[model samples]
Target chain A: MTSPWAVIIVVIYFCILGLVVGKWGKGKEKGLNEFAVAGRSGPWWLIMFTVLATWIIGSTYTATMGYAVMSGAIGIYMAMYSVMGLIIFYYIGPRIWVWGKVHNLYNLPDYIGRRYGDRRLAILVAIAGFIIGAPWQIMALKTFGYTTTALTYGALPEVAGMAIFAIAITAYCVYGGMRSVVVTDFFQGIICVVVVIGGIIACIYAKFGGIGPMFQQVLAQRPEMLVIEDTKYWTSIIVASFLGAYCWLEIFNRIFLAKSVRDLKIIARGAPILVGTVYFLVGILGIGGSILASVNVDLAAAESGLLTIFSEVGGPVLLAFAAIIIIAAEMSSIDSQIATAGVVLARNAVNEFKRTKLTEDRVVKLSRWIIGIWMVMVYFLSIGELPALIVIAIVTYEFLATMFPTIIIGALWKRGTAKACWASMAVGWIVCGILQISPVTQAWFGGWGAGITGAFFAIIVYFAVSLASPKDEKVEALFAEVEAYKEAR
Target chain B: MGNKLSRKSKTRLGFAIYFVVVIVPILALPTLNRLNTAEPFVGPFPRIIFLMLLDYLLVCAGLFALYEIESRRGDLL
Candidate 1:
């Protein structure tokens, strides 16, 4: 059985998360700026941790390891997707950072609004954000709930565990807003880093009987896990990485929170190294766990694979820390998703309700309500037991991959017409959506190819249409003007 | 416009492509296999520990290359 202290620690951790968020970005509740971007005053390290933690949420941790277990060596391709994504973002990010800092851009839709000089595109993007984000929130909660259950060894009902986590996250978010999420992220990030290091140590120690033997064993068992698959998969991993980089709102927002232009570069350069270390550690852990599972353990627990490995290998006490780590990881993601959804709904959907204006306070309140609704929906959806959580988790890469060209081109290419932006995003979103759902595509293309195809279409359509399409002079001027902001600085 | 890649930049670009295309593909391929090879004749080293230690070194080298490219492109600006 799992330890009781693990559950208590998680509960206490969240409460602390709530208190921290409420304290940092409170006292200025009137303007939307504070609620949305924390008055654009975040230090680089805090934002860095948030970006790192956000990407490695419960789904990421669980799914990546599960993938390694099931897919063996080929699974490491997913991390490559992320690496490519970050590299591409390096080019596009600074430009966005320049405009966002100058203009106080808050969310993805806000960028759309500014780029097109139209609230309609903003609203459209917001609606899409909610649709894209809602499913993710549920997935993260399922992870939080499952880890809690397993850590406690099923002392509490699964539903009860899910409900408790959902409520705690919701309460923290509602009370603290983005500030709370950031505060908790720092805590979660620290706990996660420590646990991951411990997990890596444990995995290494257990697998080879020591550091020396671990590699010998993994090499003896599955040496291929040590390398990449081939061109088709490697190329796919690269493309997906670039695409995955753009699809994340947390990354976008982190760039927005840069205290100076220099901070943006610092984050881009430094944050990746830190996150890469974290990813490599988890990836190594996955490799080790898979080697163990090959001997006897089952790989069917798709979401709880990491926890299962730790429990079996390290005993209950270390399992307690690991579970706590996973819970914190889940909360980091859940908080970000809820915040993103709330911002989207209030600014997009609720604003469209006609004649009702959304004040900052009202938007925050509505976001809290939306968070509750999202939690409930996700809890139910998670019960259905999706076919492959890793595939689903990485499925977002297809959506992101397709959207990346449009988002980057729209921001930097002064000649990029709004017509082309819409076409590209729409085509990318649609193609990726179809590929994700179609069984034929799933069977033939596998998880990796779907993203490449969608991205290819998006780029081709975006450019072809962009050249043929008429230019918006105002947008061209804005892009030029934003460039000057950097020059002047 | 004048801030584009120079001759040195082109050489660096070629090296990068060679590394990514030929070398990276060669390294990435064996990951698909189920059986772990204890063969000592592969690319740089045979042991996972040696590869890992080399990977860390390569990662460091890659970071340095990236820094140089970005610095030249004036990412700091």
Candidate 2:
């Protein structure tokens, strides 16, 4: 019943508490600063790694490989949309930071509200952020149960295991807020990197003699797993990815935390490499897993595909390590979702309803409650059959991608009128939603292709509407202030 | 006069290198695997090397792009 290695890793994992505890005195207990952005104490390198590790969750590890196993190499080709998205993150991240600090905006909705001077638009944006973000959190819960259960080889029932992990994530998030989450993230991130690289190496050595032999076997057996077929798929992937990357709430939240434009630039620069390193490693696992799965390997368990492979190939000890690694991976994103949801809701939704307004403590409390509510809703939604992992990822990201042009260009363009923001967002959302329901998404734009349609319509509507409408003085002033802030920094 | 490049020029040059040097190498690495000279090393290693190189190039290009975006928000439509 007891895996000694699992117990030890759990202890070491808790030992990473030192980072959070040490950061405690550094104003972590203070207002919104401590709860949301770690009081802006972290440097660019650490923040970059934290973001990368969180996004690369159990779903990323397990599902991507599952797809690779099922669809050949194009599964990774499908997942590469995320890589392109992160690469695009490197470009726009700094601008958000510059404007974030200048305007003193704490959440995505806060930025929108400031830009348009419209609380209603801000609320609409917040709802979109929350809706898009919730599926990813739900997926994490499913991954948690599936992965931990897989690691234990069905020692724990999937539902019970997922519930326990979800409970622990909620407890810590409630107590520590973003402060606790970031500290835990740093710990989980290191485990993720070490285990992924180690797993990939071990897998390659086990399956084939080495990397060379593995590819030869793959090339001999499955060639579709080795090459990209369509150039349009790649183009669509990159453009759609750029849209997703620019609009992600977590990335935007980090931009707000940045101390200066210079710091933002450094973080943006570091992110792609950090993300790409892990992405490349995961791609290797996909390649290796494709060959292994060809031998009728079942990737039925959701979260810890690597663990199933390790359990079979390596031993119980490595299985335990993979379990801990998957847990760490799941925690990284779960906590971020909780923290980001709390920040946006408190600032955009609940606070607006208050007379005297909510305190930071009250806001933190509300965020915790939101996390609980979100988990329960997600838990119920995931009870039956699961959606395709890549499909869920694309749908949610495509939904959020509608916000990209408004948020990114709205910050820089003084000529972008309020009418433009409203019209663009309305059109984009309606169009994207219609497309998703229409046969267009299924027939022509299946897989990574549907993403392009949503992103394309969003950007086009945003630009054209803004050009057609007249400018708002209030919006112009915000842009002017942003310019001054960038110069001053 | 020694030709002194402006920051804008440096950024443009960086973008150019990104497309030319970084992307070209990655795009070519797959072609190299077609040679089929060796087994494991031949097929995968070159692709991996190019990807790793592309990762570094992307990091640099992203930074250059971020800097350019921030400094030139006025110029952006």
Candidate 3:
């Protein structure tokens, strides 16, 4: 059972966080642009931390450790998607930032719509972004729920845990919007890095003296865990994960908030080191968990390995620290997703469909309501037992991965027409859906992995259709404008 | 401090890092796995772990160098 002191500490932590939210987020409410994109004026430091915090959600803690425990060295491959995605972003992010600034864009669909000159495609992609994006929030909430329940030894039920987290995240986001989210994210990001690194260090000291001994223990006792047994799954996951990196709208949305294109480039350079250090530490913790399990640590669930290790090695204090880190990671991600989803729904879906000019204040209000609705939906979905966090996350990535050709090719290649964009998206989704749900197809092509297969087909179809379709004079003109804009920069 | 190099040159450099740091490591994993036998420990870590850590460090260093060079060239935006 959780100590009463720990509970009090957590309650105090929440109150403090709430106050921070109120201080920075309150009275900052403004038009939809300020609410959604922080007036597109975030500095490199803020952007760096917020982006890192947003990406390194609860799954980064739980799933990385889980994969490491399950697959040994191959578990480090878990960071493949993020690392690759960030690197790719180094190139693409500046362009997107510049485009968003040049066009007064607010979301991915906004960019797509303006780029393709198709409002309907924008709406479709917005809906698709929500569909693909919502699951990640749900998964993060579920992770929060499960992790909290585990921390409290079931004194707090999963539903109650989910509700607490959902309410806390929703309140802050509703109050402050993107400014609040980014501010809180900067704070939360610091907590995560400190606590996670601290917890791992404590675990090493308490359990096996140091890194060298812990690794030696694992090698001696559980050598098989050190081997990369499944080569096909390993390779497929790396490829699919690299592609999956681009699919996240929340990450893409950060491009819009960048103060300048230079800020994006700076972030791109520094993000890998930030992400690498944290994930690498988590990977080491996973190795520690594997060693602990070898000695019969009685981990209740594989997903809870990191927490369980903390409890066993560091006692209540360290466990409480671990709890805070997990909560910080979850909340940072949840708030960002909630805020981004609201923007996508309101600006792209509702506002675009209405074709009515709403006041900035009204649009902000609508976004808050949509955020509330999204929170409730995610809360309900999170209550049920779902697939493993990584599996669900990857599946979501596969769905979003369909947008790659449109996002990447459409930006660089002017031949991409609206019809081609829609066709590629539709065909990719259908193929991925078939591969995901059908047992026969999964078994037949499971080796290739559904994500990679779908992406392959999506890319092929995108190029074929774009080549066949006649080039639009408007698109040609837009590309020329984009080139001139680049030259001006 | 990032004005010396053109955006195209910076992008090309980014792609080059992507190929060397991201793509090459992933492609070489299969071949690396072949050597994942019971090798002696390099310092505290196993051979594979040491090699992976080396790869990660190389990526970190490469990215840092890219940023430093670009930043030195003058402001990009």
Most accurate candidate by DockQ: 3
TM-score of each: 0.84, 0.83, 0.91
Interface root mean square deviation per prediction: 5.4, 6.4, 2.5
Error of 3 at A120 (Å): 2.1
- What is the model-wide C-alpha lDDT for candidate 3? 0.77
Q: Where does model 3 exceed 4 Å of error? A: A26-29, A294-300, A355-357, A384-394, A439-446, A476-489, B1-7, B10-18, B28-30, B74-77
Q: Positional deviation of A23 in candidate 2, in angstroms? A: 7.7
Cα lDDT computed for each candidate against the true fold: 0.65, 0.64, 0.77
- Interface RMSD against the true structure, candidate 3: 2.5
DockQ of each: 0.21, 0.19, 0.42
> Per-residue error at A399 for model 2, in Å?
2.1
TM-scores of chain B, in order: 0.43, 0.38, 0.62
State residue A58's C-alpha deviation in candidate 2, in Å. Answer: 1.7
Better of 1 and 3 by lDDT: 3
lDDT of 3 by residue, A320-425 (tens): 7778888888888878888998988888888876757677688889999999998998888777666685476667887766678888778767898888888888
Error of 2 at A396 (Å): 2.7
Count of clashes, each model: 11, 3, 8
- Identify the runs in model 2 with alpha carbons over 4 angstroms from their true place: A1-28, A78-83, A293-304, A359-361, A380-393, A440-448, A486-489, B1-77
What's candidate 2's DockQ score? 0.19
